[model samples]
Target: MDRLARRLGLRTDPHIFFWSAGLMVVFLVLLLSFQQPIGDAFGAGREWITTNLGWFFILGVTSWLVFLIWVATSRYGNLRLGKDGDRPAYSNLSWFAMLFAGGIGTVLMFWGVAEPISHFASPPFAGVEPYSVEASQDAMGISLYHLGLHTWAIFTLPGLAFGYFIYRYDLPMRVSSVFYPFLKEKIHGPIGKTIDVFAVLGTLFGVAVSLGLGTSQINAGLTALTGVPDAVWPKVLIITTLTAVATASIVAGLDKGVRRLSNLNILMAVGLMLFVLIAGDTVFLLRQLIESIGIYAGDIVPLSFWNDSMAQFTDEGGWGWQAGWTVFYWAWTVTWAPFMGVFLARISRGRTIRQFVGGVLVAPAAFTLVWFVVFGWSAMEIDGIGGSGGPISAAVADSVPLAMFAFFDQFPAATLVSGIAVVVVALFFATSSDSASLVVDMLCSGDGEAGPVRQRVFWGLSEGLLAASLIVLGGEAGLAALQEVITVIGLPIFLLVFAMMFALIVGLRRERVPKPVEAPARHQTAEPRPAQESPPRAGSQT
Candidate 1:
């Protein structure tokens, strides 16, 4: 415990800890106390935002994505995150694995098969028929857009800003540290404390929401495979089981626990994708992936700008769909920025600015595209196009949790693949819990001290309890309601992210460059002894 404390900076910043943890505790208490009113209020606020501020969500993510790409390709690209001679803390493969696992492993696993199918069944826009060829294309395209570089960019900028400022300027590993270039020493004042505290809230609520969603999906999977009753008890059981596993992983530390689990996640994900590909239509899935990339690239420009404003009057469902899915996704990813950034910054110490962007943003987005294409396209083919007349689409339409298993049932060894999926989901959430605890610990601790192992257990269990509470409170509907609440909490983070961007640019410009040394005057002593002739530029003087 002593060693851990020293590693995490060992000092307690009460303002940050109290504000962050206090806000969350108060929220949890109020939520449970006045569930109906709070849920209603959240629902109302969500509707208003979706109705009015959809454009902001759309433009914000797209602009950030463009901005990060510009940064990666600009003159600052070669800038090392650390000093010039430093090497990366983790190897490239391990780094990417951890990043993928921590950033969106749970999200992708939960939505990979479900999203595409859902979109196909119910087109978000008007004039599009469900389950048509065009709808299928739109489905994959929309799914790609949601999980693309845009989402990763939300995470990448903060990591870049935090990593650059923290390592280059020798600042603390806290969100406020990114403001050091602009705020200078004020980072230690109340303003800095507030920023760090909000970051903690953002991380806590973001992970808590994910845990809620994950428990629901896990329950769905369990009920489908093992005939477990899809009740609050089963969901709670799932949360408890996984939270215990996460506690063990958290105790094991990042390298031994998180890294190992992340590597296993990637391997399992690849295996699942391959199983679907080979078991279904190998050639078709490969073509779908390439074609999906092309479709996504071509449509992203207009799609990013598309706010579905026209559909507001013509179709009520249009705005609701955008709010429920795209806006919610953007908000979720935005909320995840601080946690993701702090976690990424820790492991990405030795990377150059360009490497960090490529690894953190581009690589994971590309991998997501492939994962979607494999599962999504295959599901569409098996159920919609190939004349298989499978129940996958119907199952998805009825319940999202059943989507993957329904797809798996189409192939041989249904039970085996489904079982693998359950394990993957569990482990992914465990990684999330571990990573969230570490990031939140950093925020509250105000540095990279390891802190106490008990804190990890506390956070892991807290997340589970919060998730279980939401489930018991409202079931899947409760999770959806919490999504809106989480988005509301995320608005502050969106502002912080933009501020961090400006600070990063300022800090990079102020970075010190090595000056070249001048060679000494040649043979000064010998030349002085020989001494002396005077010469004029145009004419000699006697």
Candidate 2:
């Protein structure tokens, strides 16, 4: 295996590289060879996880949020992620841009208008009248709940662990290294390798979900603009084209490719958002933004713990909705945790724990909230509360990919704005794919450095292939398959995240408490406290 790798010019951990790639290949084969059975299996898996462990998902993610908050406020917050004199690799603006772009740029674009409006049309709360003002508030708040601090908390914990261990302790840049305190030397053994293998699988499926969504949305944009048909072939073509673009980016490496594209994503996103705010009801959106923040804050506590236990009796489909939306989201985010965690840690060197936690938790989330309000509330207003048979709502129910474009159609310069939205989604797609590929490369290489171009290109293309295959599996069913697979895969990764939290706590405690230096006893003092250098009295001058 080593000789084969060497011959291929691939500098990689044979265990991780071969196993992860092989497993993915087998999965693809199974998916394509017997699409129905594979899809059914994924569906069953999703159902089982959501049914049995839905509350666990809720409680686990909420715990991470609480844990991160405590860590940021605790004494451990002062510890720097790197050496004492080390500073951030990127400036605050660039760092934040990369953070937002890498973390959830594609998802925000895909779901910004869709999710809030969906919630407004069908309020999660039983008594809340759909499309009412309360429903609108609930919609925005729920959107915030899904995309806000909880989501970033999941990313922050693993990122904090990776950064501290890799930079401070000089451990290898692998998910298993986060367990160095517990695994000790065994982090090099099968146990550690298995952890990394799961990390790779989770990352693959997680990023595939984003790639699939981006591709679908891109196809939707093209379909709307050019009268192209939205079908399997276009999505496959979109995935192929974007994957090639991502491969080039990965080959260019992080700073040259991913960073530049990420910055562009932020600029485009902000510009588009500002256009909506200014062109639309600017004052209403501003007011809604403030109110949504308050609504989110007030409801965050109950929403975090709401498992919809009673829905089984009263509302037959309520639990299903929770499972489909909240549980699926938590699971999906958990799958991305390793990818985002590694990416976050890679970019977050030289930051203090408090800074890393606070920035990660707040910055992207704030942007996400503002985005939902600007786009989501705008869509709701245009649709008149409960949609009232509006085109945007129809697109959302019929095809989520078309929802944003449908909303933009209501504004002036719809063509131009829709075109820019497509560019934003495409850039976000490219950034996400390349970022995941880079992270996977790091995981496979064992040392976190860029490997051979062949390796990078291979992972980047593999992500596209997997995404395309899922789309081909059954189109919409393929997309649901992506969600189901992530939800199932997320169970173990979610548990792994908790273990990471424990390991981080132990490591942080050690860092927080300085080791005591042994002083020579009075009877055995060799050179302690010479008479001429005796300590000064409390009140005496030197």
The 0-to-1 C-alpha lDDT of every candidate, in the order given, reads: 0.79, 0.85
TM-score of each: 0.90, 0.93
Residue 527 lDDT (model 2):
19
Clash totals for all candidate models:
6, 0
lDDT per residue as tens, model 1, 28-78:
888889988988887787777777787888898888888788888876676
Ten residues in sequence with the least summed lDDT for candidate 2: 533-542
- Tell me, by TM-score, which candidate is best: 2
Candidate 2 TM-score over all chains jointly: 0.93
Output the lDDT of residue 321, model 2. 77
Candidate 1 CA-lDDT value: 0.79
Q: In model 2, which residue pairs have backbone atoms overlapping below 3 Å?
A: none
